[model samples]
Target: MRPQQVIDGDFTYWLGDMYALLGEKETALRWLRRTDEISNHNYPWFERDKNWNNLRSDSEYQRILADFQRHWERYREEFGDG
Candidate 1:
């Protein structure tokens, strides 16, 4: 039963990335934000993913990137680079 709570993070991330590649900025952003909340995509992963390239100059995408960085900082403070 405990495993029922686990989510397929990769799938969500895929949806976000796919939407981004399709040029659906708003939809991609929404899914990407949800992916971040559920899976916590790392900076390296974000950087190397070309799917999000279309959003590089987008304000909302930048904001999401900032939020992801903040989460990483908090994680580091608590876990010390686990």
Candidate 2:
């Protein structure tokens, strides 16, 4: 059976984490990006998240981090720091 849809912030975060662990950096980033868009509570997790450990040294990962930082800054300005 297909997995049930996840409609919560934490579930999206964990799904991103799972994808990262599975070595799917692009997919993981996509899900994590969605979590960022949907939930302010998930912002702090990215800095020290273990799921992204493997990607730490990758150039693509650095780009993703830069993009995330930009998005986060914009989010803070628009939403008033959550």
Leading candidate by lDDT: 1
Top candidate (TM-score): 1
Tens-digit lDDT track for model 2 on 1-82?
A: 1123455768777887898999998777677666655643444567688778987887866665666677777778999955
The residue-by-residue lDDT of candidate 1 on 19-59, one tens digit each, is 89999988788777776778566866776788898899999
Task: Score every model by TM-score.
Answer: 0.77, 0.58
Deviation of model 1 at 22, angstroms: 1.2
Whole-structure CA lDDT of model 1: 0.77
Error of 2 at 58 (Å): 4.7
lDDT of 2 at 5: 49
Candidate 1 runs further than 4 Å off:
1-7
